[model samples]
Target: MMNGIEAVIFDLDGSLVDSMWIWKDIDIDYLGRFGLEPPPDLSREIEGKSFSETAAYFKERFSLPDSVEQIKADWNRMAWDKYMNEVPLKDGVGEYLDWCLSKNIRLGIATSNSRELVNSIARVHGLEHVFQCIMTSCDVGRGKPAPDIYLAVAGQLGIPPRACLVFEDIIPGILAGKAAGMKVCAVEDAYSLEQAEEKKALADYYISHFSEVLQG
Candidate 1:
């Protein structure tokens, strides 16, 4: 489905790693520190937000006494071990990235996650040198659905928007890529299974794994 992809931009969380399932547990546990349970809308409220943005939201939403930066620090400490040791690269991803590297295809990461967490995962996976650019919404002004993150990635990669292919697992990330005038490929993730059809409809293509792009 991709026709003019000179570069590939990826979303990190659900797309690159099987890490989403652990987030709800983190949220519950983090809130439990303050003797609170996660709110019913916790997932919805945090969806697509930058790491710092989410921390601020949590502080305000739960009336926590901690400052935004402190909240972020606490969560980062909680999540660092999981990201470094337990997060597995999604199926076929390492091979695909290696293949793309051999072909000199520029790769970049544009994510809502913080730079520290992204680095932690990269270090553990030994993928620190793979991406030409690693950007977060904090580097730009907004998160997904605003187009800023993808555009920033393409800009730094020195590729035109139309020459970039974005791989994402969630609707917001897909829309962000499309909004930036890039071709988007929606990847399957069990956490987002309910929105599979919506993802395919919004993306330029949909694939179960990165190897599908090699076949294409």
Candidate 2:
């Protein structure tokens, strides 16, 4: 679909894997244990932040007794288990990746998720070999909407930002890619389809599924 795209960058959680919804459940279940409930905007606030950033947001906002590091570790443990056991690749992602490989386009992942969680999911889905580089927001000083993570991934791949096409599921990620001077394609998965049009407004392109890219 991209005529001269030399590299493709993907967002892990909601774009490549169907695990975004699990986070909401995890937050509700975990907070309930402490007799607390997250605010309706909690997820939105943390959606494009690193693990520590998200945990710190929760800690301060909810007045949690645990330290930010402790909350991050706890959340990671819970998320890693769920991801390794239950998250599945979105339909046609594997095939689309194979096509990119065949076309000799470099592939990389730029995510706000922790490295451990990203590795666990890649290992479980046998995608460790598919991506040339997998970068987490923690690797950079900032997360999505800041452009650092995406720019880092492009640098790692030895590709200029304009030569890369980023596939994102959230508005922050789309903004990040744009800020990095990369073309952005918004991927509509179950979690983001309701706001697909809104996301598209910020993206250069939009695809309902990976198959749609292949068909193009």
Candidate 3:
């Protein structure tokens, strides 16, 4: 509903695909391997962090023996398997992307996930070609809630931050978009709706489904 928005930037994991719940399973299984239970707040801590940041947090919090890269690789192996073989797009996202394309709105992806992970899921959903740019937090010096990632994406798209709209499902992503001075549309997912409502009030709009985008 924001006027004069020229581009749309999307968050990959829970926003575009139903993969957040998969992370919970990964956390439980991975921690259980060492006879440890996942800390209650583990999911919240990692929700908006970059892969490397998350690994570091896990290592420190769990006293894990693996190096950060090793831990990340292990997590990626399990995640990629789920993403490639099991994850599905959030309902109606493909149609919504097509609608945006038809409107000639530039599109980009800005995610805290690694580039490999984002590309894998985008490829599985046939969305690789739909985005003008695919930017990962690794490409920037900081991750979500920092504004750096979204600012980089806007720069890549040749759009002013005020002229861009961001679609985000998590608090950190929404805050990042807001910090970048863009209009944000908070998208709801099974795992994030309640948290989004309570913690992401900075978003300019809220939609439970991508289909809501077509209503404009």
Candidate 4:
């Protein structure tokens, strides 16, 4: 049950929110601007990378002419509407957040998303104040699977890594939390259906929905 965990760290996209779908679309359209299509492994290729890192990957992979800032700006522009208006909290996440708040457990978000996109989602969902701290990959200067972002969030929350419990949907995110010496729960996301088993194996716990953790 991961007893003694004092704080819960969450990954925004695909974990607490259903925003993973938007990224693939963004990648496809972003590459199309260079008259190219998203590679079949595009999602895997950019997994665990920060916004700027992803942009750098795109530029070099496609031989694009735009600078990293230009590419990041373009992605932000393309993703703004969907993140603001369409993305919804993952099933049972709102209730889970309420549970955490009631229990006085600290909350922190360690995400690969840009600060703008994360803020937009948090604002729309009225979740801006629920967290004790919010940290982006940009803030850490590195992305998930590297442990930097997770460590940064833990540091901001003033919680020891072993006292933090992380919920993640992707392999990279799970790895990041574990690397930070935290207990990780791999949550289910249809977008990553193929990696469901792999995620289960890597995580300290596995649940199909946040509700399962609550129910227990």
Index of the highest-lDDT prediction? 4
Q: Give lDDT tens digits, candidate 4, residues 165-207.
A: 9999999999999999999999999898999989989998998
Which parts of model 1 have CA positions greater than 4 angstroms off? none
TM-score of each: 0.96, 0.96, 0.95, 0.98
lDDT of each: 0.89, 0.89, 0.86, 0.90
Candidate 1 residue 11 C-alpha distance from true site, Å: 0.4
| Cα misplacement distance, residue 105 of candidate 4 (Å) | 0.3
Candidate 2 stretches with Cα past 4 Å from truth are none
User: Considering lDDT, which of the candidate structures 3 and 4 is the better prediction for this target?
Assistant: 4
Is candidate 1 or 3 superior in lDDT?
A: 1
Worst 10 residues of 2 by lDDT: 188-197
List runs of model 4 lying over 4 Å from the truth: none
lDDT at residue 213 of model 3 (Cα atoms):
75
What's the residue-level lDDT of 141 in candidate 2? 67
TM-score of 1: 0.96
lDDT: which is higher, 2 or 3? 2
Q: Which candidate is the best by TM-score?
A: 4
lDDT string for model 2 (1-216, tens) is: 588899999999889898899899889988997998878778778878987788788888888999988887888888877898889998789999999999999999998888888998889999999999999998896878999999999999999999999999998899999999999999887776768888988998998778988788
Q: What is the lDDT ranking, best to worst?
A: 4, 1, 2, 3
Please give me the total number of clashing residue pairs in predicted model 1.
0
Per-model clash counts, in order, read 0, 0, 0, 0
Residues 1-216 of candidate 1: C-alpha lDDT, one tens digit per residue: 545667999999999888988788899999998999998878877888888889888988899999998988888888888887788999999989988898788999998988899988888888889999999998997888889999999999999999999999988899899999999999999888989999989998998987888898
